[model samples]
Target: MEWLVPVLIVVALVVLIGIYLWATYNSLVQLNVRVDEAWSGITVQLTRRADLIPNLIETVKGYAAHEKAVFENVTRARAETLSAAGPGAAGIAEGHLQQALRSLFAVAEAYPQLQASHNFLQLQHAFVDTEDKVQAARRLYNGGVRDFNTKIKVFPNNMFARGLGFTEREFFEVADSGAVSAPPRVQF
Candidate 1:
């Protein structure tokens, strides 16, 4: 019965390996989903901010129609934010949007009437809220990326992660610190 024992041992090893692979694959799928959800959260916040921008621009435009360049810059940045495909691109777009918003706000600063408008004030508050949400969403996305990347890079998982279709996720970070050094001063 020595042959029977060796066969049983081989079967046991195969079963154990199969179990390991299954668990690892499932974990990776879960992490991938989490990261995607986190990214969606970021996108939602960004979209909210994008939607708020036009109203803000219109409000400012009523008071500062002469500031055509500022309005155009904000509009272009909003388009970039809307069209950005991935986290890296979105981060860069965010930098541009922030700078544009700052310039828009700077122009608004010259018009006390615009700053004091009820509509403008409400939009400003909404923009602030969206910015806060965007920051939170970015944190969640990057955290998920960090966890997923760690899982795929750890000893045994690393050997088969790529084969299983898991890959590293890009973190959302400002590509140019200088471009976004100062937060958009939305406050009057």
Candidate 2:
């Protein structure tokens, strides 16, 4: 009777440990999927922004033919961003694109005609809205990565995490502070 009680206690402990590990593994998987989904949201917004750039450039070109250098820079930046593969590479390319967009907007400000045009205004508004969404999605992705990475580093879970091929995710960082920071003043 004494041996039976000890054997049953051991069995119960083993089962509990098994269930705990299973739950941890599933939670990690869910977090990883969330990160991927959030990344997709960012990609969607980026594509929308990219699609709008051509139209914006065309409209600006019609009104500001003399601004060829600015237009070319925007085009080149957009192409580089679209071609970038991973998060790190994309972040660098995005910073360049953002700088170019800022220059383009600055040029537009000089031309009252372009600013007043309904199509140009609408496209600019849409691009701004898309940029906001992309930023939000990036935050969510980073949060998910943080959670997943933390889980995989904890004690018992870390053992199973390594065995399951789970690895930490790279953060999508902005390469340039100027790209994300407030616009610089151009006082006369």
Candidate 3:
């Protein structure tokens, strides 16, 4: 019957659309998970660096007692990094923290005994290791953001993504070029 054929065609079309929608939703979910995981990686590195800051500050403080302003700056920056609400906020806070740390080490450089101390050298090595990890984690997070943003902005998927809760994610980046402009003046 002509009527029966038309009904079957309509049903087939509906089934196809349902399948497509399901696949798109799943893709979005997977991409969102990757973005979250990548962010966690960055946070882990941030936390590690935060944990190292106080010890570094104390080590330098013992030798550079007159540098109260530098110590205060580092302390405030550390708190900012810890309290930052998101990657965008954290990146800015981290840049300030790195600068404070540089000033701290720069002042420490004036003290020959402190620079040659076993404790100070060990701390510097640990800080350098954490900084490297942070760089790798940042790259991973940015890559995830790029993938997720592209998925939510492209055609077909974009058409349905907005209907869902899939929005573009912000990429994490350095707040200042100066943050990485100098290769960490680790000169003991």
Q: Candidate 2, residues 70-185: lDDT per residue as tens digits?
A: 99999999999888776788789888988898888888878887788888878877777777788888898888889989999989787779889899887788799678685321
lDDT of each: 0.93, 0.83, 0.88
lDDT of 3 by residue, 26-138 (tens): 98899999999999998899899899989988988898888999999989999998888788898788788878878887898899999899999999999999989999999
lDDT tens per residue, model 1, 95-163: 899889889999999999988999999999998899889989999999999999999999899999999
Backbone clashes in each candidate structure, one number apiece? 0, 0, 0
Top lDDT prediction, candidate number: 1
Clashing pairs in 2: none
Point out where model 3 deviates above 4 Å: none
Q: Model 1: residues >4 Å from true position, as ranges?
A: none
* Candidate 2 minimal-lDDT segment of 10 residues: 179-188
TM-scores for all candidates: the values are 0.96, 0.90, 0.93
What 10-residue stretch in candidate 1 is worst by lDDT?
174-183
State, as a TM-score between 0 and 1, how close model 1 is to the true structure: 0.96
